[model samples]
Target: MNDADLVDNLTALESLLQVTFHDRTLLRRAITHHSCCPDTAVHDSYDTLEFLGDAIISAHVVEYIYRTHPDASEGEMTAVKSEVVSRRVLAQVGQQLGLFPFICVDIANLRTFNERSRDSLCADVLEAIVGAIHIDQGTEVAREFVTRTVFPMIELVSTHAIDTNPKGRLQKVVLQRTGHLPRYRVLEQSGRHNDRVFLVGVFEQEQLIATGKASSIKEAGRLAAREALQLLQKKDKRSSADDTTA
Candidate 1:
């Protein structure tokens, strides 16, 4: 894209972000990915802006959550923070904002598109946008941007624990409750080459409670573990009610 096109694009982004940039160059730098060029001297990349934005994002998020949830304990706050700042969460946010089409990547030599790398790039750009907003506006504006955009996304995904590492969260809960960790095992593998599929089961005390299937083993395991976690939560609630009545 030429200078004029770049300027138009940045303007559109600023409108979408609801913040104008004082230094339009900073906004440009925030959207540019390093993979677009081999030279480190390139000014049109989000890496440096991403670095600055990350700190700003963290501080803003922590402060918002700290004030919003005064009754929440430190451990709860930490867990919530981890969920909010996680790469997966950020990538989802980027995807929601349709940022991938604007991204410039160097993929000519690669055999396949690296989803993880793409996600990271998206996450970095989100952070860079945050940085640009902070620069263009004030800290209060930046904080509002973070609260309005990032926090709502986090909360939406957090409800019902959808699209999150529920197994990991459940494991922590289980460890605190029973002092025993859950385990996962591959039940079956099928298909050929790139079309492979895996089935996994989650177990506690050698008794299987949930099973899931996915294209990747890790995904299957996570799904199964999440199912197991849900079941365990239901059982725990029932047991607690029974004890209370007794």
Candidate 2:
């Protein structure tokens, strides 16, 4: 977009964010992509702001989880925090607010914006905006902004909040059963590089106990481990019942 169009878009974005900037330049830089910036030598892009925003978002999320869930375990709070501040969730929030259209990326870069890349861009921009708010308004306003935008995401994870470290739990189970740790192997992979899906199997010795599918291998492996853990626990209960009857 041209300068006038960009200015108008920024004005609309300010309304969306519900905070007008004292230094409008900060907001502009926050939405700027490095590819669009002429001076490569000068850091006039969103990278630093994104970093600052990440910290700000994390702090607020951790604090919120701590205060709200006093009876929750540390691991439970961490899982909730991880879900709240995750890139995927942040991108979803940005998408909900229609933030991607305001990003100042080059036309060339725009062509490469697939769904996965667009999500990544949205996530980065969300953080940069938070960073900009922190700098322009102050911590109190930034905290309020995060609380308003991000606190609601807790519902997305709350219903499914189990142990996030499923792999660690699976390892202990495998060690107890067979005196060897479980291993994961990719059973299937498909789709493009930026959005590939993986089907992973969790094995105990030569037996493939369970499998899980997801976009990332690490997540897929964790899922497989969770499934395997559940399967093993059920078998153990069955065995105890059989022994009692015998």
What are the candidates' C-alpha RMSDs?
10.8, 13.3
- Model 2, span 1-246: residue lDDT tens: 788987898899999999999999899999988878868614789989999999999998888677555435677788888988899999999898889988888858465768998889899999999999999999999989998888789755643553466787678667877899898899999999898999999999989999999999999998888787666656765776788799
Residue-level error in angstroms, candidate 1, position 102: 1.9
List the pairs of residues colliding in candidate 1: 32-46
* lDDT at 40, model 2: 62
Candidate 1 per-residue lDDT, tens place, 59-98, comes to 8778866755443458767777887888888888887787
Candidate 2 local distance difference test against the native: 0.84
TM-score of each: 0.60, 0.63
